[model samples]
Target: MQSAELQGILPGKLIHMLNLMRFNFNVRFISVLSLVN
Candidate 1:
């Protein structure tokens, strides 16, 4: 039962983490572009 719950939650958690990483990357990219300009 616990494992099943974890499995259900895992994809959401992974997507959340991926979103965070993408956001961080976008922020960094914008900062670099500003600095370059």
Candidate 2:
């Protein structure tokens, strides 16, 4: 496998991971806000 091929694949994987983290963070933020109110 070439470095070029690996580079092409890594960003898609990283983006997927980031999206999942953002979703979980948003859920926690909303729950915290509700508790404070």
Candidate 3:
């Protein structure tokens, strides 16, 4: 029962983490671009 619940929740957690990483990357990229200009 706990394994089943973990299976359901893991993917959502992974996607949320991926989204946070992407957002941080975007912010860094924009900052670098502004500094160059």
Candidate 4:
């Protein structure tokens, strides 16, 4: 109930936050990969 309501109103904001988190994660992953090479 609450999840659906928030999802309805904040879909764009949620996606933006998720993208930022994924980007930060990818950056960290790449740095670690580079260090191993």
Model 1: which residue pairs collide? Answer: none
- Candidate 1 ranges with C-alpha deviation above 4 Å: none
Please give each candidate's TM-score. 0.85, 0.72, 0.84, 0.72
Off by over 4 Å in 2: 1-4
Evaluated against the true structure, the overall lDDT of model 1 is 0.99
lDDT of 3 by residue, 1-37 (tens): 9999999999999999999999999999999999999
Per-residue lDDT tens digits for candidate 1, residues 1-37, read 9999999999999999999999999999999999999
Scored by lDDT, model 4 comes in at 0.95
- Comparing 1 and 4 by lDDT, which wins? 1
For residues 1-37, what per-residue lDDT tens digits would candidate 4 score against the true structure?
A: 9999888879888899999999999999999999999
Models, CA RMSD each: 0.8, 1.5, 0.8, 4.2
Per-model lDDT: 0.99, 0.98, 0.99, 0.95
Candidate 3 regions exceeding 4 Å error are none
After aligning candidate 4 to the native by TM-score, how far in Å is the CA of 4 from where it should be? 13
